[model samples]
Target: MKECTGVGEMSEMGRLVLLGAPLGNPADASARFREVLATADVVAAEDTRRLTRLARDLDVTVPGRIVSYFEGNEERRTPELVEVLAAGYTIALVTDGGMPSVSDPGYRLVRAAIDAGFPVTAAPGPSAVTTALALSGLPCDRFCFEGFLPRTPAGRRSRLRALATEERTLVLFEAPHRIAGALADLAAAFGPDRPAALCRELTKTYEEVVRRPLGELAEWAAAGEPRGEITLVVAGAPPVPAARPDDDTLRAAVAEREAAGLSRRDAITEVATAYGLRRREVYTIVHT
Candidate 1:
């Protein structure tokens, strides 16, 4: 591609550009990231200060009007940003870290821009999700993203229980303070021997990627405070036995899962699928 600077220069009326920034190390920033931030007419940033700091580090002079659009004010600010975008102005939406709308707030504006007949796209760059998954040494052919989990212990456990039998590799973002609790929940929900990796401060000086089972990870985090941003990659559940699971076997499996705090309904569904049986049969077996 040529050296394209501005979005308005294209054939579209207005464009909503999701500009990606580095997760930790600023050098991972792409040239296109700088160009979009430097030339776009309206720049919507999760944090204005952080954007400026990034530009300074990259030696890229920002020539656009910067506006704050984070989780707190995204709902209120969507209309205003859509208006600017509708007027043939290019607006770059960036987050404090990572891309917009992954775990950050930009979906509303992106939707509004699209509804208004404006073009939308992303200036792709570093993402903690893909980066961590690449280094996680786990299956990546099929995977899923489980953003930040609930804060309350009960709520978190409930969500983990729901995902207990998920077969695809899972990617999650978590805060430092809740690392131990989350790992413990994973251990309890997915079993202590479940394979997992904890990636911390990605691409930064204190960066650490610890690969182990959920139990060992929980123990490690309990030993010391694991600080900074965290991305967790968890291996999927192991394959079940080839032998057809009988009613007694299915009931035991469901009961064990239910005892692990999963709802009866979820337990039945999981057991039914695991043994390739109709949900009605599993439901009858569990309820009666």
Candidate 2:
């Protein structure tokens, strides 16, 4: 473990520290985080109000200058922060919650620092992403963080459709109100039987994690919207069949569809739906 030092102590050496704060619970903050907050010469925070509240909870006083560094100003602030870093300031970066740069402001500054040969490191803490992953009961060994889905239904659905066949477990963040719609879209794109978990208010008094099939979860979310922060974890699609269907099987499926008095396109669609085969595969078999 590295010892935390004040900015004055490190003024001679230029460095940028990406500090991870507690997602919701202050108790999850590490000792090093307190020290960094206490000593950093410049504290770049996503939200000053939230940062102050966190400082009060931890009983640590920030001796450095605090500045806003959020989505709207990140691009504009990056160059200025970089200048401070170059001037040998031990700058500490923090987000409103959780780790900075995961889905928050800090990436640009960290990247700039690294490119400029300034020392860079992290002080890890609680993450909604990992917390949800643990509660999800889904495979976490291989997973991808999608951050938040698009706000609109069409955009969100399109994004989910693109990941319909993704094999690695998926993690996403959603607002309380949008959770139900997101779940519904996920079920439609990934199938109803896909296992998933909805984590809400993690590490707080009202923290809840509900694990169920995506279809069932969507129904539950529809009944009533949840409050507080949310993290959604969904199981990935199973390995696809390795062998293609033989010509005989395809002919039999097409014959059954034709006997039902359906058009060729409708018949192929029905067969594909019934057998869980791709529409193009069924069409190729029927046409050829």
How far does residue 64 in candidate 2 sit from its true spot (Å)? 0.6
Tens digits of per-residue lDDT for model 2 on 125-227? 8788988998889999999999999999999999999999999999999999999999999999999999999999888899999999999999999999988
Pairs in steric clash, model 1: none
Global lDDT of each candidate: 0.88, 0.88
The total number of steric clashes, by the backbone 3 Å criterion, in model 1 comes to 0
- TM, every model: 0.81, 0.81
List runs of model 1 lying over 4 Å from the truth. 1-12, 245-288
